[model samples]
Target: MPSGGDRHARDLIWGRKSDALRDLNRRRVLRAIMVSPGTQVNLAKFTNLSQATVSGIVQELQRENLVVVDGNDNERGKKVSLSNVRGVAIGVEVSYDTVTVAARRVDGDVDRVVVDWSGRGAEHGSQAWMRECVQLIGEVVRRTGLDETDIVAIGLGIPAAVDPRTSTISQVAWALDWERGMDPGARLQEHFPGVPVIMDNEANFAAYGEYLYGAGRGTETMLFVKSSTSVSAGLIIRGLIYRGRHGLASEIGHLVMDPLGVVCQCGNRGCLETAVGGARLVEQVRGAYVGYRVDLPNSLANIVERAKSGDLLCRRVLQDAGRNIGIALSRTCNLLNPEKVFIGGELGRAVELVIEPAIQTMRLHSLGGMFNYVAPMTVEASELGLKAGAQGALAYALTVHHIRPN
Candidate 1:
């Protein structure tokens, strides 16, 4: 009973809705493929699409050359992957003393580069780190035989909390003096104009990386603790990084451990960082050798190496740090009850020295249900190690729909 004009308007609105829904489904399929290639059945499960819908989408994508289907078996059994010709995703991790870059192709190939900037005096600040980041990105991209124009999206991970609303650095700990409120994504965007930039905390990206491809894979809930010049934690819930309000969800370092302990950078007293952070552990070892004629270990890595080589003082300090970290993690576990916890960063290199004590302490303080024989929670070393952050950044960049293949 509608008039001709009314009918045309209704039809247009329905057409738009249909188109939008189709595009969204296409994006979901593409994202699942980016995570890892699989058959139509697996893709259907991953994307939560009906098998018929997945088949139709796969056929459409194949015709457009966006994805390739292989195997001489039935259509449902063939593996589907993103075309190797698709543009690359770039991920960069900027820590206090290091800059790591990774370039990942749509076909699952990756090239990476890492540089140590500790010797570059602190006076240079953000400028020096940004410059090094640019160079490292360029180097890694070239290693993949790709140019700047071939970059689809970039993920920048910094050792500071990034405000999710503004995509800018919100809070910096004492270890990194990066300017507060600076938009690292915008700065990186200037270098690679037209490429979208995704910025987040390095720990968040590291957690995502481990969840996708390392120790935390197959877990619905996981925690990644990054212990370096500073201490921070990232939580992965259902395959997504849980960045809570203002993007400071898992800031375990600021957790109060002592009421009247040394003041912390965030103006807190007796934070977990004060007790177990890399700087504090290094300080403890150096304090032990003070006024002695013998040379002392200077950096956390040095302390770790000394500990591995039978330095009782270094071992004891790290063990204490591990115990304190366990205490903090116990509280966290009691709340979130993650399936797994992965320890990464510089301290992770000495897993044998730290993980056992941490586990012992955590078992003591955490709820007994967490240690039940069946499906017990476990803590392990990060399989991806220092590369987790950068690789995670790369994987995350690919997940964002910055650009569609032409």
Candidate 2:
């Protein structure tokens, strides 16, 4: 009973839907190219679509001026880089007491890198900190000679767990005492409306940071331990960070070392952090120096310095902490069998004073032969150190590209 006009309207609706689907498929194809530039044929295999479909999308993307393809010239095996030219990408790492940002040029060969830093904490209740972030970003963009419209996407890493379902923070009490109900992603989205704000846990980003530019370069699987105000770890397997169920995979600080031990901020007793975190280390050492107005370094840096000067007190304390860390690491190693274990954050440089005891304890408790070849598993100090979080933010944003396999 349909009239000609009704049939025409239905045809129009179907045409719009077809275009939308094509655009979606084109975006996916482009993502694959951006992820690994030289990759080919694999995108179709992974997408479970026909190679012809992928190729057609690629052609459409290229025609739209969003992607460019270059030939391998004489090399038959060399695949083209499905280059994207829409905009640059930015990454930000907002921590308890600091904000770090990084940016990179998206399209061209003139690689530009910008680093932004501010001492604004989550406790600042969003406004002051958001202002600082805006100022920093604006300053960096101007410094790099790119306009606001030139930024395509932004990624952020935070310490608190972000609920995957709600895209809201799961619990902020343990990490940020003041801003318990803030949604950092929403705040970021407010600033850069229209751009997607991708958020992740700090350890996940740190693991990727190490894998991309630091101690974990070329590692098949890596364990990155962050020892600072708190102790946490991240896992990188096959060169990708493992985000556990609910995006809270690497919560290593809460692995109970002693049920009767000191309570953690997470309401757990005797967590690894309760024993080896910066606050506890400083507290333990402060009682030794009474009236001298002793000021401890943010990390155990001063302790490492004192230990290097042959101070048995500092050495003993650090060694004890190392033993505790190793005890936790041994269990983790048994479970994951990682090829490398990297130490970062404030306490990373103290590996020399700590690694021996950690190694001894790890050997004592682990299952046989799992870690025998883990020799030179290289318990390395982070070259990136405290900057890892910030630097990782930038590199992550720039590198996550969408592409099509040709």
Candidate 3:
């Protein structure tokens, strides 16, 4: 019993609702396509839309020249891909002493460039590291044959916790002396005006990278432990990086193992990092070889190489580190119960020397249910190695729907 005006108003509201729903559906389809190009039927499967709906949306996108259909197969069988978009997504990872950048075009031509520089300063709050990061980004993008204006989005991974709510560096990065509430993303955005810069913990991006293209590909829940100069962890659950409140969820390095042991850079005593971190292991090796008049290993990579070459002292240090990491990971496994655990970074390179001991120790300390014969939790070395963080950042940047070529 509505009047004419009331009926018209109701119709208008319904029309707006319908339009909004359609737009949302379109975005979902586009996001799925961005992740992996596919045919209309495969797109329907990925986007969870009806075949008819995917076909219609794809046809509309094709008409707008946003996507192109290729292959000489039938319409449904033809592969669909993004048109030769003029933009590229860039991923940058800032570690304690390194900056790595990766760039890829949205047109899916497999053209990508990855570059890394070592010995960069470790102060996350200082301008030195930021300047180096910007330089590496430019270098990598240029190698990809893309100009600065071709950048659409950038994903930056830092060695500190980022507050998810504010997108700022949190006090948890005390080891690097990063100021609380410092916004690295904002600084990068200044250089790439109008470009969206996404930031997260480097370990999180590394986990995402492994989940997308490396060892964690088939896992429903995976944990990636980056044992570098400092140790950190990242968790990926069901294809999404799990960032708990304050972005400190998987800070396994800060776990207090020995309350009376050496003080950590974070001011905590005897955290896992103090025991198994790269610096600590290197210190142990150097301490043992003091005044030996032999060519001693200077870095973790050198130590790993020496261990592989059957250096007993280097092997022992890595073995002890593996055992210590296992002890901490056992506690983490009891809580998150991930399907797989991947060891990445300098330590991961010595898989046979490190991973075997770590696995044995983890098996001893972890919950028995995690080691069931039917589906035992497995641990492996990262297939992507040191480049995981940068690759992950690149893939993550491309996942941002609005950043797609307009």
Candidate 4:
């Protein structure tokens, strides 16, 4: 119905649209590869693009030096990953007595270090811990063979509630002893310029880390509970951290278990923290052995060690703490319907002494129907251990856009 000129015009328009779509698909392929190394088949599934589309885009990206392919050229044989032209990302986790720093390219092993600063209090030590943290991060990056200028993104995980919108600490996290709304990332930025910083609660990052690279891998929904000096939980729903409004979504430690129980740092009484926090467990053990032949536990870590060495009192305390944790988690399981629960923190190292009680308690309180379903709720120890938060921070940094070197 149209002349050659009209047909030519239509052909040009269609060709341009097709080219744009192809470019978009190329980006999708690159993004998938950046997240993790995989074969073309995996990339197609991750990007929801055709194998042919991924193959074509991957070849183009390879030509442009934007991607690196591993192994042979067979479609399912070779693994494809990003070339890290944008530099590496760093993850920092600052606990009450320890700081861990990790650095890595987008898809490889990370260089990490853990430093104990127990006696050097952050608040009382004139914020010297911040300087130490910066130094440790630099050291880790150096181990990765990358200079300071190569840092593109930094993700920080602090032991406190962080306001996502403001990127500052929340008032409820009084244990930090810093200003209620102080931005730790902004403070760290002074040491590393031109790098975008992302921050979140340490437990949240740990949960994400467990989801991405640890015990919660492949789970549709997962919950991670940190039972240390303080009690906290992180929820992952559909592969993403579910930070509710105010960034205080999973503060299960503050759940009022007994209005008449001990007062928490948040000024709340009888919270789950009072019953199962690491400090509380240690205190119970010390009080019980004050005038006995058994030695007193100076810290929760010590108590866990004693439990593993056949200390009946220590084992009972850890088991009791686990049951209490399970009681709190049962309530969480009822509401969130998480598929798996991961136990982390200093106490999680005790494993059976703690987790067994928790699993039993969860069964006692959680809905029976959900457990009867095809996949009953599962409980496991954190695969990343103390490094979970730091690793999660690194993974988080990879997901964000950072300043590129010009």
Residue-pair clashes per prediction, in order, are 0, 9, 0, 0
lDDT of 4 by residue, 1-406 (tens): 1111111111111123334677657655654554567889978876778888888888887886666788867766689865535355677877766677777654453323332223342433327777787877777766665567666567888877888767778754466567778777888888887676788898999998888778787788999988787788789987678887778989999999899989988888999998988778878888888878565788888989988999999999999898988889889889988888899988779889999988889888999866788978888889888778888887776554332231
Model 1: per-residue Cα lDDT over 368-391, one tens digit each: 999976899999889988889888
- 74-176 per-residue lDDT for model 2 (tens digits): 3323343434343455667766666777665444332345777887855565676668777777777666556555665667777777665455566554556
Task: State model 3's lDDT.
Answer: 0.79
| Regions of model 3 farther than 4 Å from truth | 1-19, 38-53, 70-79, 109-113, 400-406
lDDT of 3 at 107: 54
Q: Report, for every candidate in turn, its global Cα lDDT versus the true structure.
A: 0.78, 0.65, 0.79, 0.74
Q: Order of candidates by TM-score, top first?
A: 1, 3, 4, 2
Task: Tell me the lDDT of model 1 at 350.
Answer: 87
* RMSD of candidates 1 onward, in order: 8.3, 8.8, 8.6, 9.2
Which ranges of candidate 1 are over 4 A from the true structure?
Answer: 1-19, 71-77, 109-124, 174-177, 401-406
User: How far is 402's C-alpha from truth in model 4 (Å)?
Assistant: 7.5
For model 2, where is the 10-residue window of minimal lDDT? 1-10
Q: What tens digits encode model 3's per-residue C-alpha lDDT throughout 115-209?
A: 57646745544587788878877887676666677775789998889987777887555667568888778887888876778888999999988
Model 2, TM vs. native: 0.76
Which residue pairs does candidate 3 place in steric collision? Answer: none
As a TM-score, model 4 comes out at 0.85
* Residue 169, model 3, lDDT: 82
